[model samples]
Target: MRDLTSTEEFHELAANSPVVFMFTAGWCPDCRVIDPIMPEVESTFSDYTFVSVNRDAFIDLCIEKDIYGIPSFLAYANGSESGRLVSKDRKTQEEIEAFLSNLSK
Candidate 1:
């Protein structure tokens, strides 16, 4: 996944492609669990945009968006919020795929 390190990059990405920006902290167990499997998401949605945001690096944005939990997925289409899939319990491959596939249309 591409690293979205700055607000400019985040906005640019969200505005450009059918992107999914994941808000996760490095220390979060749920994030660690999902990290390795993200390659599958990247491959599956090769035509769509996929990005990652480090919560520690961008806390203000996270709070502004109310990203209270790790593994929160902010799915955007042309810079708008299309959907969200969040929480430790819901961060699964199938869940992610389902959300991405449904919105990809």
Candidate 2:
């Protein structure tokens, strides 16, 4: 997965391919809860541009997106958002699978 540090970097990722953008923080417990599981998701969706943006380091970018929480996932395709998942609870693999399947269609 790639780490996007700027708004322009995120925009580039969004325009390049199907992107799964994750907004997270170093001290967020929720983010830590799902950190290990993320690599599995990344492996499953090799075709996607998996991008992680640290909320603290990129506060301006997060504000522009109106991000309301840590561990928010946004999917982009065709230069626009196609889906989103945001929460503290660890999302099930089935949920992730279903979301990706729906977006890929």
Candidate 3:
């Protein structure tokens, strides 16, 4: 997963192809849980570009995007929002896979 440090970089990446913005924070436990499994998730959904955005680092952007929780996922395709799997709930690998499956539909 690519780390997006700024909103500009996020927009640039999301403009062309399918992109999934993973809103996370270093101190977030849920985020840590998903960390190790992300490589597999990325490989499974190779069609989409995955970008990691640190919510704490980009507070304003997170607010603007209505990212209220860590380990949230927002999908964008062709500069438009395609899907979202955002919540305050702890996520499992199956749930993540389901989210990607839904996005494809």
Candidate 4:
């Protein structure tokens, strides 16, 4: 997954393709847990572009997007939000896969 450096970059990417923004932080254990598994997830969901957004670096953006949770997942298409897997609870690979699966429906 590519790291989103700026909000403008995120918008540009989202405007063109199906995007899944992964909101995470370096200190988040849950985020770390998913890191190793993300390669496979990305491969599985090849249709979607996955981008990583560090919550600490983009706190204001996170707030603007109402992403209050670490390791949150938000999907977009044509620059519009399609679905989200945002929560304070820990996320599992199954849940992440399910979230992506449901987005297609």
lDDT of 3 by residue, 1-105 (tens): 989977888877777779999999888999999899999999999999899998888989888888898889999887788888888888999999898888842
Q: lDDT of each prediction vs. the true structure?
A: 0.83, 0.80, 0.87, 0.91
lDDT over C-alpha atoms for residue 71 of model 2: 79
- Tens digit of lDDT per residue, candidate 4, span 1-105? 999989899878778889999999999998999999999999999999999999999998999999999899989886688899998788889999999998852
Better of 1 and 2 by lDDT: 1
* Structural similarity to truth (TM-score) of each candidate: 0.89, 0.85, 0.93, 0.95
Off by over 4 Å in 2: 88-90
Could you tell which candidate, 2 or 4, scores higher by lDDT?
Answer: 4
Candidate 2: global Cα-lDDT?
0.80
- Each prediction's RMSD to truth: 1.5, 1.8, 1.3, 1.2
The residue pairs in collision within model 3 are: none
**In model 1, which regions exceed 4 Å deviation?**
88-90
Q: What tens digits encode model 2's per-residue C-alpha lDDT throughout 40-77? A: 88888877878888988888877787777877888988
Angstrom error at residue 58, model 3:
0.8
Candidate 1 lDDT (Cα, whole model)? 0.83
Q: What is the C-alpha local distance difference test score of candidate 4?
A: 0.91
